[model samples]
Target: MLFPASGHTKAHVLHYYAQIAPVMLPHVAGRPASFVRAPEGPEGESWIAKNPPPGVPDWVPLVPVEHRDGVTEQVVVDSTAALAAMVNLGAYEVHVPQWTAAGGRDAHDRLVLDLDPGPGADLVVCCRVAERLRQLLDEDGLMACPVVSGSKGLHLYAPVEAVSGRGASAYAKGLAERMTVEHPRLVVASMAKLERRGRVLIDWSQNASAKTTAAPYTVRLREGSPGVAAPVTWDEVAACRAPSDLAFTPEAVVERAAERGDLLAGLLGEGVRGRVP
Candidate 1:
C-alpha cells in the first residue's frame, strides 16, 4: 500500500495518472519533473528524486538540467507509459518547474501563485484571497485559473508570453507584495510563519526558475484521505463554503475530467496568452 492510513495501494496511484494523462500531459510533458516518492507509503520515509530513479527503463525520456552545483538528467513525463513508470517507482506526487525544456531553462511561459492559509485560516479564507487575486490579475490584463491544491491551499495559474524566469518571478513577487499592502488583514506576503497567522500567504516564490509546484491532476499524500490537485472554475471557487467543498478525490477528478473536460484549457491556447505588465 502506498498510503497505509488511507488504504491506497500503488495500483490506485497508477490508475489515476493513466486516466488523467491526456489532460495532465499538456501541462507537464516538456517540463523536467521531480518526484516525491514513498516506497513504504505516505507515512514512511519519502524523498524527492530530480534524476531518474534506479531501474527506470531506457525508453523513458531524460532531459539534462543544470543546477548551481552541476547538471542532472531529469525525467520528462511526455506520455502515458512514462507517467506510469514514475508511479510504479512509488512517486505519489509529481512536480515540475513553470518553464519547459523545449522553451529552454530561462524561458518561462506560465505564472503560478500558491495561496497558502496559515494558522486561524482555512480554505474559506483562501477562497476570498483567490477572488481578490483574480481581480488583480484582470487589471494587469492576465486571466488566472484557480486549482484546489488538495493539501490545505489553492494555486493560481496564468499563461504569459515567454519571459525569463527571473522576470516572471519579479512580476509575481510584486503582485504578492501589493496584495499584502492593500489588504493587510487578509493577506501576508512574508514567508515567516509567525506573520502568517490569521491571513493567507501569497506564495509568489514558486515562480522561481528552480522551484516546482505540484502538477495539476496529481494526487497528494495527505493523511486520512488522499486529495487530487484538481482544476476548478471561477463559479466553483466562489461557491466553496468549507474545505470539503473544494477537496476532490482521485476518482472524483477522473469523473470531472470526463464530464467537464479540462477546465484550464484556456492556458494551453495561444490566443489567451498575456504579458506580465
Candidate 2:
C-alpha cells in the first residue's frame, strides 16, 4: 500500500485514477505535470519530480519543457493508462500549469488566486475569503470557481481569454493588493508570516509561468488522512464551516464525481471573458 494512513494499496490508487480519468484528464492533458512521489509509502519520505523518469512507457505522452538548466521531458498524463501508470509509479499528487503545454510557458488561459490561511486562521476562514474573492470577480464581470486545496486552504480560478502568464500574474497580484488594502482584517497579500497573523494570504504569485497547482481530483498524501483536491459547488463552499467538510478521500472523491459530474468542466469550455482592471 502506498498510503499507510488510509491503508490504500497501489492498485487502489491506480483504480482511482482510472475511474476519475474521464473527468480529470481534460485538466491534466497537454499540461506539463509535476508529480509528488512517495515510493516508500505515505509514512516514508516523498519527493517532487519535475522531469519524467527513465523507462516510462512509449505510449505515455511527454513534452520537452525548457527549464533554467535545460530542456527536460516532462510527463503529460493524457490517457487513463498513463494516469494509472503514474499512480503505480508512486505519484500521490498531480500538479499542472494553467495552460496547455502547446501554449508554451507564457500563454495562460486561466488566472489562479490561492487563498492560504495563516496558522491562526483555518479553512472556514479561507472559505469566507474565497466567497469575498468570488464576489469581487463577479463585480468585475468575471466568473470564479473555488476548489478545496486538499491541504490547508482554497484555490480560486478564473478563466479568461489567453493571456501572458506574466500579465496574469501581475493582474492577480494587483487584485490581491487591492483586496488586502480594502479588507485588511481578512486579506493579506504579503507573504510575511507576521503579516498573516489573522488574515488569509491571497497568493496571486501562483500565476507565474513556472508555477503549478494541484490538479482537480488529485489525491494528496499527507501525514494524517489522504486528501483529494476535489471540486466543490458554490453551495458547498457556502455550507462549509470547517476544514473537515472540504477534505475528501480517494473513494469519496470518485463517488462525488460520479454523482455530481465534473463541477469544473465549465473551465474547459468558454468561461467569463474579462481582464483585471
Candidate 3:
C-alpha cells in the first residue's frame, strides 16, 4: 500500500503528484487546480522547478504556498473558471496537501458541512446521514457534494456566495447549529471532543480559507489510497453506503460517475435561503 507521503523533499512531494495526478485530473472538470512546492513556493521559479508536476502546462502562475498546523499546502485552487486556465497552462497536475489552509480566496462565505459519524459509526447509518444531508440541501437549493474522510467519516460541501452580504463564518455557523438543532444525532457543532467521539461531527469551519479540510484525491497519511475526490451529484451521494469500503482512484470515480450520474446538480439554483446572521 502507499505510505503517507514523506514531507522530506520537494522532489518527493512532486514525485507522487507526477505519478498520481494523471490518473486523477479527469474528475475535476470544473475547477482551477494547481500545485505549490513548500518553502521554495513563496520565493519564485525555485518552487516550480523543485516540484514541477507532470502535466501542468506553461501558463499557470506560481502561487504563494501555505503551511498549516498539520499539513503543507501548495497554494492552488480549483474553480469553474480556473479549470479552464489549468488546461491552458500545460499539465493538469494533482497534489497531496500535507497541511491545508484557506483565507485569501473568494471562497469565503461559501458553506462547508462536515458529515462525521463519530467513532465506530455504522456504515449503513452513516450512508443514511449522507442521503439525508443531500435531501436537506436539495430542498433548500444549495450546492453540495460528498467526500469520504481517510478515517471513518464523510463530509458534505455546500457553496454559498460569501459576497451575498453574509460573512462565510456567520452563514456556516448558523447552518451548523440549525442542523444540530433539527437533527440532534445527525449533526454536532460543539468543540467538545467528548461529544464528537461517537457522532458525526458536522464541521462548517472551512468557510474561511485559513481553516483546513482534506481535499479529495489526496491520500491521508494514515489513510490508505485516496480515491476519486471529485464532486458527486445528489443521486450518487444518496445512493452511497459508506464509500470508504470501496477503493478510490480518479479513474474509477469517473467511470462510476458516468454509469451512475451525479446527484447534486439540480440543487445549486438561485434563491438558497437562511443566511448566516
Query: Who wins the TM-score comparison?
Result: 1
What are the lDDT scores of the predictions, listed in order? 0.90, 0.85, 0.47
- Candidate 3 residue-wise lDDT, 73-168, digit = tens: 232443333333332333223332212223345434345566666665554455576676666766666655666554456666565544321265
Listed per model in order, the count of residue pairs whose N, CA or C atoms clash below 3 Å is 0, 0, 33
Sort by TM-score, best first: 1, 2, 3
CA error at residue 5 for candidate 1, angstroms: 4.2
Q: What's the C-alpha lDDT at position 64 in model 3? A: 51
Model 1 poorest ten-residue lDDT run:
1-10
| TM-score of each model, in listed order | 0.98, 0.95, 0.57
lDDT of 2 by residue, 1-277 (tens): 6766667787787788888899999888999999998877778988898977555778888889988888988999988888887877777799998888898887798889989999789999998888888888888767898888888889898877778888888888888998888889888999999999888999998898889999888987777667788888899999998888888888988998899899988777774556655
TM-score between model 2 and native = 0.95
Better candidate by TM-score, 2 or 3: 2
Task: Rank candidates by lDDT, best first.
Answer: 1, 2, 3
| lDDT tens readout by residue for model 1, 1-277 | 7666667788888898999999999989999999988787777888988988998889999999999989989999999999998888887799999999989867888999999999999998999999999999999889899999989999999998898888998999999999999999989999999999999999998888999999998888776778889999999999999999998888899999999999889878888789987
Superposed Cα deviation of residue 250, candidate 1 (Å): 0.3
The CA lDDT at 44 in model 2 is 90
